[model samples]
Target chain A: MKRDLFIIMFISSILIFPMTVEEIFDKVDENMVYKNMKFTARMNILEYNENRELSMDIFMRDENNILIEILASSSGHTNRFMKKNDQMWLYIPNAGKAIRIKGHMLKEGFMGSDFSYEDMSENRKTNDLYNMELLSKDTLYIIKLTAKSSDAPYKMKMVYIKKDIFIPIREEIYSSSERLLKELIINEYKKIGEKYIPINILMYDKLKQNSRTEIVYEDIKMNAGIDDKYFQKSYFER
Target chain B: MKKIFLFLIIIPYIIFALRFSGEYNYNYYYYQSLNAYGENRVILNMNADKGIASFHLQGLGQFYIGGPKYIIPYPDNIPNYVIDNLPSYYQLSNSMKINTAYLSIYYLGFNLKFGKFPMKWGISQTYAPADIFSSTSPMDYSYIEEGILGFLGMYSFGDNTISFIYQDHTDYEQTKQGLLFENINNYFTASLFSAHFFNTRRIFNGFVFRTNTVEYLLSGFNIITDYWGPGIWIEIDYFADVEYWIQDSIADYSHYFLIAGVDYTFNDLLYTSLEYIYYSEGKTDGFTYNDILRRYLNDNFLISKHYLIPIIGINQGETISGEFAAMINANDLSSMIMTSLIYQPREYLSMDLNSSFVIGNLGKDFYGLPPIYTFQLKFYY
Candidate 1:
C-alpha cells in the first residue's frame, strides 16, 4: 500500500500546469525592469588585439527616460547622453548647449563598441515592442519575439530564458531587414535581493568578423530614489 | 599672471581631487610654401564633487615653435607698412592660459557658478551668430573654447529657465551683463537672450600704447530641434550698436547676423551637414586691406555678406574617421576646403592627419595662402 501511494503522488506532480508565454514573460519583466534604477558599467571594445575601454554611470526613470554620464573615456573629455521618450541628445561638455540627435543615429556603434545606442536604450519590456510566443522548452525556454510596431529597433528576436531563474541567457537579434545582425550571450548571474541580474555580457557583430564587445554591469541598485531634477532639461543644461 | 593660473590649477587638484589628470597634445604643420611649425599643449584637469556643490578646472600651456623665422614681405599691391613695422611673423615662445575654472554651487533650488567657463549660447553648429562671447573656428571640430570669466546665476521652474550673467573686465569701460531665458518642449528647445558687450582697443600713442574700451549692445534668438527627420537649428543676433570701427561701413545701421543649418547621420558610417550664414556687417561691394584690419581687430572675421558651409564625413564610430568640409563665400565664390583623418588605436592614444587649401584669385578672399598639412597626436592620462 505504501509503494502504490508513492507512485500516484509522483505521477500527480508530473501532470502540473505548464507556464504560458504571457505568464513566463510577465515574470521576466518583473525580474528585469524597474521604475527607477542606477548602475555603473564598463565596456571593452576589442579591435586589432587592443582593448579600448569606457566607463559610465547610468540613471533610468521608467523605461523612456535614460541618462548616461561618461566618467572615463578613451577619447579624453567627459560627455553625456539623455534619451527622453523617443528623442535623444548628446550633451558635449563645455560646448554649452545640448544638440538634438535623431533616431537613425541610434544604430551607430556606441563608443566604437558592438553595442549600438539602440542597444543601450532597450530597457523597456518586451511585451510592449514584440509579440512573443513560446517556441520550445527543455533545459531552457526558447521564445520567439516578432516586432509589433514598424518602429521597433529589431525585426525579430530569439530570447532563451533559463527555466529555473526566468532570466535570459542568450538573445539573437535581427535587423529591420531581417538580417542576422548581432548575437548577445549573457553569463554570471548574481542574486540581488529577490532578483537575478546578469553581470557579464558579450555581444558579437555577425556581419563583421572578430568584432565583439564585452560589457560588465556593476553596483546595480534597483528601486532607488533619485532626484526628479536629474531627468529634467535643466539637469543637462546645468 | 602665469603663476596665478598655475596656483589656481594646482591648488584645486590638491584640495578637491586626489588624482591628477591631464592631456598632452603635439601638432606639426607643413605648408606648401615650405614652412613648417609645431604646437605643443599640456592640459591639466580637476574635478571634485561633494553633496550639491562641485568644482571643475582645466588649464592649458601651449608652446608654438618653428614657422617663418622672420616676417614675410608683403606683395607690392598690398599694403606693406604694417608688415614693415612688425618684427616677427609669430610668437616662438609658449604661453599659459586658464581654459576653465568654475565652482558650481546649488542652494535653495537655485544654481550659481563663479569663475571662468564656456558660455554656450548658440544653436548653430559650424557658425553661431548668437554665440557672441567667443569665436568658433571652422576647422575645430573639438570646439576648443576660451571660456569667459563671469558670474552666472540660474533659476529653473517647470520646463523653463532664466539666467543672469555678469562679467567685470579691467580692460573694458563697463561690465558685461547678459540675461537669458530658455524653454524646453517635447520636440524643440528655444532661447532668447539680450547682452551688453564691452571690448578693449589698444591704440598707439607714439610714446606708449593706450587701452580704449568700446561697447556693442546685442539681442538674439535661437532654436534647436529634432522633430523633423534631420536635425535643424537657427540662430539670429541683432546688434543695436555696432562696434565703433564697424560703424564706418554701416554708420548707425542696425547690424544683424543669421545662421541656419541642418545635419543628419546615417547609422555609424556617414554624417553630413550644411549651413547658411548671412551677416549685415559684411560688405557686399568688396573688401580692402583697411577693412580686413578692422574686421580682424573686432573679431568679425567673416568678411562676406553671404556664406555656405557643407561637411561630409565617414566613420567607424570613434575608431577611424574621415571628413571633408568646405566654407564658401558666396559673394566672392572663394572657398576653403579642409579634409581630416583620425585614428584611435588604443584607449588613451589618438592621431589626426589634416589638410586645408584655399581657392581664389590673389586679391580675393582666402587667397595667396598655401595649403597646410597637419599631423597631430594626443595622449591622455
Candidate 2:
C-alpha cells in the first residue's frame, strides 16, 4: 500500500509540473520577440478569379515601431508606412509628404490584403493580452484564448500549437459577437538560429468570399542592428 | 551650361548604382462648355535609386481636340529679360515637355537635394498657408504639383528636424531662402517656417500645428477600442511688407493668412474632412474683372477672402473606392465639386472615373469653368 501511494504521488507531481497554458504562451513569446528585425516578404492576395502580388521590405524596432516600404513595383512608385507608438503615417511618392493615419484605419485591409493594418502594426505578447487554456492533448496542443481587453483585434482565438516546437500551427480569430473573422494557417516554418518562424502564413478573411492572403518571408534576420533613425517619421522619406 | 554638364556627368554614376522604376499613365477627358472638347494625355515617370542617391524624371505629352484652344494654359510670351535669364534646360513647347528632373543625396544623416522637385510645407492637405514655394494652379484638378528649382538641406534628430531651402528663379529676378523646423511627439506635431524673398523684399513666416486624440467609447466600435479619432490642424502665415500688383500699380501691405481644418474617419471605411481658409491679403471689394486678371497674370495672387472645402471618401474593401471633394468660395457663393471612382481589377492595374462640376454666376469663382469628365487607365510595372 505504501508503494502504491508513492506511485500515485509521483504521477500527480508529474501532471502538476508540466508547463501550464500561461507558461507555454510566455515561452512562445520569448522565442518570437526581438529587439529589431529586418525581412523581405512577398504578399500574394488571392481573390475569386484574380490574384495580386507585391513585394515589401520591412524593418521593425522594439515592439512598437515598424517601417514598411513597397519594393519597386510596376507603377514606378514606392509607398511607405510607418507606425511609431500610437501614431501611424503613410507616405506616397507623389504625395511628397507623409500623412497621419487614424487608429481606426488600422482595422482596414492592408493594401487590399486579408491582413489588417492592426495585424501588421502592433506586436503584443500573447500572454499579456489573452487568457489561455489547454483544450486538448494530441500530436498538437490545441489552446483556446480569450482576449483580456476589448482593445484586442479579436475577442477570441483558437490556436493549434506544435507540441515540441512551442509554435502555433493554426489560429482562428473570432469577433466580439462570436462571429468567425479570420483564419491563419502556417504552411511552412523555418528554424532561424534558436527561434522558429513561420515562413509562409496563409490568412483568410472569413467574411470575404473566396479571398486569402499569403505572406512569405525571406531573408529574415533577427536582432538586425537597425538604427533608431529608421523609427522616426522623417525616415519615411528615406 | 556648366550645371547641365555636371548633371550629365553625375547621371551615369547614378545610373550605374541605381535600380530603375516608373509607370506609364494614359488619360482621356471630355469637357462641356460652349462646344464639346476632348483631351488626351500620356505621362511617363522614371526613378533611379541607389543606396543614398536618387533621381526622378517625369515627361508629359498631351493633345487636345474640339473645344478649348489649349489643354493647359500657356504663359503669355515671357518677357525677353525673363527668357534670357532662364535656365537652359527650361523649355516650353506646344505638345510635350519634361515636367520634373531632380537629384537627391543622403549622407551622414544629412539630405541634400538639387534641381526641380516639389517642396511641401504645412499641416493641411488641401490649403497650406505656409506653402509659399509653389502656387497650385486653381484650374488644375490633377494635383500634379510643379517643381521648384531649389537646393535643400535637412538634418533630423529623434522626432525633430530642421531644413533650409534656397530657391532660384532667375527668370523672375527673385530668390527665396527658407528655414523650417518641425517636431513630432505623442500628442501633437508642429512646424515653423520662415522665408525671405530677395527681389520682392518680403519676409514670410508661418507655423502649423496639429493634434490627434482618440476617444475610446466615442468610436462606436465594439471590439476595437482605439479608433483613429479626430485630427485638428491650423496654419497661419504672416507676410512682412508684401507687395501685390493691383490695378496697375504695386500695393505694399503686411497681413496674415489662416487655414484651419478637421478630419475624422468612421470604422476605417469612411473618411470626412472640412477646412476653412481666411486670406487677409485677399481683395474684399472694388476689384474690377481686368484688375483680377492683371493681378493673376503679373503677381500670381489667387487667394480669396474666405474659402471652405469639404471632402469625403469611402472604401469598399479592396475592390472599389470613391471620393467627393468640393471647394466653396464662401464670399462669392461659388463652388467646384469633384467626384472620382477608383476600381482595381487587378493588383497592378487600376481605372479611374472622375467628374467635375462648376456652379455659380458667370465670371465668378468656378462659375464660368466648364464641366469636365475624365477616364484614366493606370498600369504599374
Candidate 3:
C-alpha cells in the first residue's frame, strides 16, 4: 500500500509539472485555427491475418479541420466532400451528382476499423469528458483519463507518453466493460515547421479481426493560405 | 456464485451503455420492378443509400433493370385470377460509386469516428434488392436507397472490437412500413422502430397532432485474433426494442433476438462461415403487411421465407466462392434451399449464378429440376 502511494505521486509529478493542456494549446498560433492545408500521403491498410496494401493520395484540408477533397491515383473514381457542422455532402464522379447524407446510420466501419462514421469527425474536446492524471515521466508523460459520462466512448484511455519534442508515443483505450479495443502506436516523428506532429499513425483494432490502418503524411504544409471556398460543396464536385 | 458473478458482470455494462449512446443515419434505397409474379409489378427501380460512420460520409447507389418474376399456372383458364402471375425482375446497374470517407482520429483502443455507414437493422444484407432469402420475388424487394448521419463510438479490447452505435431512429422508421410488408419486423426492424418518432397527420392542414418516440438497443462485437487468431470472426448479437406512440393509441412494447456466427479462413485459399439465428417475431397483430405480402407473394411464387435459418458459405481464393443456406422449421411447409456459384474473372470483374427454392408443395414436386436459377455479372474497382 505504501509503495502504491509512492507510484501514484510519481505519476502525478510527471504529468502535472511541465505542460498543462492549456500550455500545449498556447504554443500553437491562434491564426492557425482555421487555415486550410494540403498534403500528399501514402495510406496503408493492414488487417489481422491480411497483407498490407497501399494507396496513394493528395488531400486538401481546411484550418477548420475538414477533409475536403482526395485525388486518388488520378482517374475520376476519386471522391470529394464538403463538411460544415452537422451537414455533409459527397461528390461521386461517376454519378455526376452530389448528395446529402444524414441520420444515425453512421456507426458503420471506416476504411475497415471498428471505428464508425461518427468517430472520424472533429467535435467535442478532451476537457469535455476527461480529467487527465499524470502517471510518469521520461521523455514522455503518461496520463490516465477517466470518463465524465458512463456512456462516454471509453471508460478509460491510457494515453501514452506525450513528450515535449514529439507527438504522443502510444495510447490504449478501454471500454466501460473494461475491454481494450484498439491501440495507436507512433514510431516515427519529424519536426514540421514549428510543431512536431505525428507524420505516421498506426491504428490497430482489437475486435480480434484482421483490421488495421496506417497513415503516413508527407509534404505537409500547415496553415498555408487556403480559402474556406476550398471546403465548399463545389470543391467536392471538382 | 457463478450466476451472481455473471449478473454482476453484465449489469454494469448494460447500465453504462443505456445511459450513453446516440447515432443518426440516412438510409435510402430504390426498387426497380424487374419481374412480375401474378399482379405485383415494378418496371424499373433505383436507389441511393447514404450514411455517416463516426461522422464521415458513406454511400451506395444503384439502378436496376428487371422486376420480380413469379407466376403460377392455373388449371384451365380462370378470368380475373392473378394468383399465378410473376412480378418484374430489374437487372441492377452497378453502383455508380461507393464512397467512404471519415476524419475522426483513430488510435489505440479508442476510435473517434465521424463519417457514414449503415446500421445493422433489417436482416437484409444487400445494399438494395433486399435479402435474397426474404424477398417475395426478386423484384418485390426494395432496392437500396437513403443514408444515415451520426457519430460512432468504438472500443478495441483484447482480441475483440466492441462498438456502441447510436443513431437517430427517425430514418429507421421510414423503413418500418416497408419492413412490415416484408415480414422482417421482428426484433431487427422493431428495434429500429424503437428509434423512430410516429405522428398522426391531417390531410388538409398537414398538421401532426402528436409524435411518438421510441428507444433502440444495439450491441455488436467482433473477435478477430484472440484464441483463434486473425482472419477469424466469432460474434454473437442480442438486441431489443421499445416503441411509444400516443396519437396512434399505441402502448409501449419490446422484444428480443439472438444471433451468433463465426468466420474463419482455412489455409490461404479458402474462407468459410457458419451462422445460426434464433428469431422470434414477437406479438403479431394478425394481418400486418408481412402477412399480406407473405400470402400474396407465396401464392404467386411458391416461396415462403419466414423461419429460423442456418447458413454456410465458402470462399475459394479471390475468384471463386459458393454458399448454401437452409431454413428449418417444425413444419416442413416452411423450409428453404439456396445455393450460388460465383467466379471472379478478374480482380475487378466477376460472374455469379444463384438458385433459390422454397420447400412448399410445388417445389417438392421437382425432384430432378432445381426450382430457381439466377445469373449475374459484376465489375468493381
Candidate number achieving the greatest TM-score relative to the actual structure: 1
Over A20-121, each residue of candidate 1 has an lDDT whose tens digit, in order, gives: 888898889877775688889988888657677788888988777888887776555566788776677787545555766664468767766888788887
Q: Determine which window of 10 residues in candidate 3 chain A has minimal summed lDDT.
A: A25-34
Cα error, residue B265 of model 3, in Å, equals 31
Q: What is the TM-score of chain B in candidate 2?
A: 0.75
lDDT of 1 by residue, B1-381 (tens): 345445545665666643346889998877666577778888877666556766677778877777623233232254445545434353356679778877667764477777776676676666666666675756332335776777788877766888898875665655678899987777787899998886565443333435555567889898877776677888888877555555564435458889898888765468888899998978764555544444434445577888999999887745688989988988888888999999986556899999988887755655645677889899877
lDDT of 2 by residue, A28-92 (tens): 77656655889899888887857777789889887778888887643445678888766778886
Index of the highest-lDDT prediction: 1
**TM-score, every prediction:** 0.82, 0.78, 0.40
Give the candidate order by descending DockQ: 2, 1, 3
| Lowest-sum lDDT 10-residue window in model 1 chain B | B68-77
Docking class of 3: incorrect
Model 3 misplaced regions, further than 4 Å: A1-35, A48-65, A73-77, A88-107, A113-120, A123-125, A149-155, B1-78, B81-139, B142-381
The Cα local distance difference test for each model comes to 0.73, 0.68, 0.41
TM-score of chain B of 1: 0.85
What's candidate 3's DockQ score?
0.02
How does model 2 fare in lDDT?
0.68
Name the DockQ score for candidate 2.
0.34
